[model samples]
Target: MASSAFSAAKIVGLTGAAWLSGTIAAISLISIPAVSRTLKEDNLSAAHAVKLWRNNFEAGFALAPPIALATASSLASCGWAARNLRTSGVKDGRLFWVAAALTVSIVPYTIIFMKSTNDKLLRYAKKEKLTTSESQETEGLLKRWVFLNSVRSLLPLAGALLTSIVVLA
Candidate 1:
């Protein structure tokens, strides 16, 4: 029963981490470019762009935390099981622990590094009408957000990579 539970946890942890990382990466690589192009259209107002950003943000906000927590829990369970099963004196679960830590760190990463950009985006988004200058500023802000978000996505990817290594070994 313990072995089966550990195996399930490993599968769940690895798959969840990979899925989270890939989804975020897709937003950065595919969705953002499409949004940028759409916003460049002369027919769309700044408000429209902001609305699109908000929709994306809300979706991601809803999705990320639960997945992160679940993945981290599974990784921690795998680590605990690994530690218990080890016969050697050396530490057994360090890789799994690190993987779990990296997976869960995205929350703080967003709060610390991505908050200012998010706030600025939200502040600008709330306006019914942006000055031409403010509209231009949104473009720059979006670019900054995309860059930071791309970096943020790496945390889970790294965790998934670590998990893969640990599991395969």
Candidate 2:
């Protein structure tokens, strides 16, 4: 039963990590660029871009915590189990530890690097009127946010890939 439970948790963690990575990739590769192009067109489009950004931000924020928790929990549990089993060589747990670190690091990464921009974007979104300068400023912020987000997206992808390799090995 314990083994089964571990397997189940590993599956859950892998799935969550994959989903999170994919979402981040989509946001970085597709959504941000699309919205940015819209922003360049006109004020109405800028407002629409803001709306889309807000929705994407909220959805990502909502999903990240739970996925991080599950990934961390499963990785930790697996790591502990692997240690107890006295597996040979450093690679036995090395990948899992790296995966776990990357998985949990997303929290601090988001808080430290992404939160201020997220807050500013949220504030900008709430504004009733934005001058051309303000719109340009917001676009600049969005560009920074997208770049930071792209970096963040890589963490989970690497983590997930490492974790999968660990499991397969």
Highest lDDT: give the candidate number.
1
In candidate 1, where is summed lDDT lowest over 10 consecutive residues?
A: 83-92
Question: Across residues 1-169, which tens digit of lDDT does each residue of candidate 1 receive?
Answer: 2777787888898999999998887777887667777888656777778778877888898998899999999998888778776532214778888889898888999999999989988887788989999888888888888888899889999989998988887
Positional deviation of residue 33's Cα in model 2 after best superposition, in angstroms: 1.6
lDDT of 1 at 40: 86
CA RMSD, predictions in order: 2.3, 2.5
lDDT values of the candidates? 0.83, 0.77
What would the per-residue lDDT of candidate 2 be over residues 2-38, giving only the tens digit for each residue? 6666667667667767777888878878988788977
TM-score of 1: 0.93
Best by TM-score: 1
Regions of model 2 farther than 4 Å from truth: 42-45, 86-91
Pairs of colliding residues, candidate 1: none
Clashes of each: 0, 0
